[model samples]
Target: MTTTLKISPIIGNSQARRAAAASFFGSMLEFYEFFIYATAASLVFGHIMFPEESDVGALLSLATFGVAYIARPLGALIFGHIGDTIGRRATLIISLIMMGTATVLIGFLPTYHQIGIAAPIVLVVLRILQGISAAGESAGSASLTIEQAPEGRRGLFGSSVTSGVAVGFVLASLVFLPIMALPEEDLLAWGWRIPFWLSSIILIVAYFIRRRIEEPEVFAESRRTGHTSKMPIVAVVRDWWRDLLRVTGACLFLAVQALMTVFALGYVPATTTITSSDMLWVWIIANAVSAVLMPVAGMLSDRYGRKPIFITGCISLAVSVFVFFNAVGTGSLLLVGLAGVLTMGVCYSFANGVYPAFFPEMFNVRVRYSGYAISLQLGLIVTGFTPTAAQSLVGVGVGPAWFLPATLGAALALVAAATAWTAKETAHLPLHELGTDRNLRLGKRRIS
Candidate 1:
């Protein structure tokens, strides 16, 4: 007697679409919590949490903001291990809950005047929880989307994760726009907490959606074969170190995001004539535009290849940072908004769109989360401090008129661009074959 083994059909395109939508909405909520804190740190926290000396207060507030990134590596390690060993669905659901809890706690916490240094200390601890929760978010979502995506459209589906980030920023700014318009006393006292508290609704919605998602097929296969890494950290360090370095180098593009969305808002208000509301409206518009453009760019990468699109974005972002800061110096809202849109919406979208597919594709399935999470978080630590570093470098007219910060941001973009160019082109490769160094034998000619 002969026995036949049947393979299940690949998940349908409609199911992939549903999964992508779920991943996108969940990511939007997660990042809304993350970016809102960054916005509040740049705008309100200095006054309410560290009201002593102006510069020092700003630095301390930003430091508390940076504390989250420090926790990101730990989050990455813990969550990445779970993602590789257990499943993406469980890890993402837990991350959403942790982030929501931390954010709501932040909204309820007492200010420095009410509770002294304990307020800032508690804020820092909550921020750390937010960071850890965020560490697994993009990687988990991207991994899930890529595994489920229809053939030849992984780039487009995966890009939704990054697009969700911009959408989240837009939502965050829009949510806070009215709140920030309140009287200064009211805003610092109460209005500022509203956005953080609203995160509970997002958490509930995300949890419901994410719980419906099944584990990705790739991860399930790894588990069945017992191919899952016993120690994801050890596997990442031993097998995928090169990809880790490349991804970390590439993640520096995040500094452009941090600087534009966080530091620039603070810098413009302090140095120029722009109000916080005006600056936030600029963010709202830029991120809204990015939400539209990121998918288009990701689609383009499918045809023209990821390297060119990724390189162009990095170089353009670097150049645009200087142009944007100079536009802010002009103190014209029109010019400032244009600069924000160009940098965040157009230029940054290239990197943002491609990285969701690009970074994870550089690692084998067994260690994909570990490699992507660790490298991405390490690079993010640098970006998290960009605002504080930019502030120190901009002291009292001794520096180069915003040139120093802009230059540093551009330099990081350049590093990302170079790293992208050096990476293997995986556009035409099948998902199973990705992340390996192999030669394609075409018509008797071998191509890498």
Candidate 2:
């Protein structure tokens, strides 16, 4: 007797919800590891990992933070292939392991005083590895979650992953609050390492949860039907280049993020009386608001449209960043916190919430992972150095030239909004029908 093994034609809602939860916690844990490095770059690395000249050290530390972006594209190409060809689950697991291991090693690294010139070199190398890991993280998580989502709900599920990113920022800030309170000597010597070390615990738990997640039926069905691409990167570039460019331009909005978190943290404390602890509080509050609202933004995209919400976010962010910097100059923590909330929390959330679904929806499942990952990382490469560039423009120890970076951010935001306007609206398209020709949708030709 011959036996046939049957695959489920449709994924259950329960499995879909489970995939969404896994994406949420996976992003939360992975980014917790990533952003802690950002916090340390702003507050601790200059003192411990570089020469004692405060200005030069601060610039170098922020430069090291930027180094990761250079490697991110490389990671995106490598892992995007794996995700498209092998499966999203395996790609996610591999990236998490790389990220977690690098973060923990950073905690144990020797200071410049102990290791001389080798310290900063090693620091930059590790930062690059972290960047590589991050390259795969959101792309894989979002791809998995959206593939599992039922029709008309992809935005809502994808937002859960983005909202987890906001939660990661909150967790990173909360963990560092006590560390930021330590005396300068203690903070530089040891307190900062604690946050990096904490990532190990989160990594282990995340690994186990992610390991059990089944591959999304959409991807699995693609493979069974012989629709999987052998060279996804080449296919994506050739077929989806227009969408690729649009995603890259839309991703320029991340410059707003670089300025909001890394640059603002360093700027507020140095140019004003706001303590590092106060800035930490600002991070906590703003990201908390963002975490709550991101899902709402996603759901709104599911109903109204992706372009409207994202374009509005770009415009609002352009305006609110200026308000945030001015509030910092006023030396009022309350105003600064409010501005931070408006900029990072409310305005940014609108674009961020829907991007996971929006970007991937621009391509067919055969190349969706590669298409989104490559374009997203290419855009990040420019924004990643934003803090270093802002520092150069403002000059260390000069009275707040906050306006320069803020102006740069506004220009980038407006450009991203314009780019977002050019993309086709994909929220209402069926998952199987995404990335098909517009003529097919218009019934000019039959859809395959």
Candidate 3:
């Protein structure tokens, strides 16, 4: 019989708290920058930078948002390597600086009227940089925080990181809500740039907060013992592709948010007479509620299992997505708000809350960052192009063209559920036994 042993990790309870806090701040700050870009892309970029054909410019500007996803894998490769060989702390700090500096620079950028064709080109470049920085933020923080937590509590801590993302969505929307209320000309001319500029204050704040956080002991232990992989991604591809594929498939649930936030935010405003302020508040309030629900959902994952909660969330989200878009189409503010909260805030929270624990636990600590980052970002590339596709299909028909976002979102959530069904139950596994458990030792019985 396998006997339980009293555990000792290099991280103590205090450091665990610090890791959780750092993870939360990193996720919050990184996604805050991202949502700001998303808002600017749909609301302002088409108007200011791509002024040729406002409609086509809007589509093209939205595509630039997708362009960032392409750079994410590159960042995953680079930072995942650093996270595996160097340390999570350094990799995260560097990524935050890169993402933050790029965002601030975008704020100072000249509009197309002032800069000609150079305007959209520069914005795309900054956006790619932001994407690269973002590639590692969530994965690195998840792996780091989960590794630092005690055996039974990994889900809660990891979920804290994702909860920060909910907070980021809320904070980003809140920052843009008043700006959305401005008159058209003022919004296009100068008001659109204010939110981007305000990120500077937070970046300065995030840097200090992240600076105090130390490297996780699991990564440190691996480094000290020379157990780290020379090329983490290669190792992952060679030995762990099954888990990688599963991670990618399960990550399709992210489509719910992509469609709901990016596609809906752009689609609803254009299709019907829904006010921009109303749509913004829908997500703002939903995400604010999600920030509270996310951690609680994570705790449920700890007691139950990741797959059940995740699958339930996926199915719930599928139904919710269809209803959310239908609500938006009807021009009912109450239904739209209710639908956004139910899907984005609650259902999506259940699925998203589990992944922080679920993803990292699928791999060993050695390649955890690489496996999680590459898989997660690679999956995101599909969802990233959704807004562009939705824009292109904007008034095409009553079938696939019109209902693309909602329909595709529901379908992808089902795909995620199917994949999640195949993962081994991991809730009861000790942190050390997580990925390496099914090896030669599994068949040999030991009496302790």
Top-lDDT structure, candidate number: 2
Clash count per candidate: 0, 0, 1
lDDT of 1 by residue, 328-352 (tens): 8788989999998999989999889
TM-score of each: 0.93, 0.94, 0.94
Model 1 scores a TM of: 0.93
Identify the runs in model 3 with alpha carbons over 4 angstroms from their true place.
1-11, 53-55, 395-401, 438-448
True lDDT of residue 283, candidate 3: 90
User: In candidate 2, what are the lDDT values of residues 1-448, reduced to their tens digit?
Assistant: 1222223324456677878888888889766875788889987888888888665888888889899999999999999999999999999999989998999999999999999899999999999999898899878999998998877888999998988888888888889888888888898888999999998888888888888789888789988988788998887776778989999999999888888788888888888899878888888888899988989998999999999998999999999988998998899989999998899989999988989899889888888888899999999987889988888878445555787888889989999999999999999988888887743545643212
How does candidate 2 score on lDDT?
Answer: 0.87
lDDT of 2 at 95: 92
lDDT agreement with native, every candidate: 0.83, 0.87, 0.84
Candidate 3 residue-wise lDDT, 1-448, digit = tens:
2232323343366788888888887888887887888888888898889776665787788899899999998999989989987889899999988988898899888999999899999999999999899998878899888888877888888898988888888888898988888989988888888888888777787788789888777678778978788888877886778889999889888867777788778778777788777888999888888888888888988999888988999999988888888887778889889988898888899999889999889988888899899999988898788777666666576764457667778899999999999998787788777777533344522211
lDDT score for residue 415 of model 1: 94
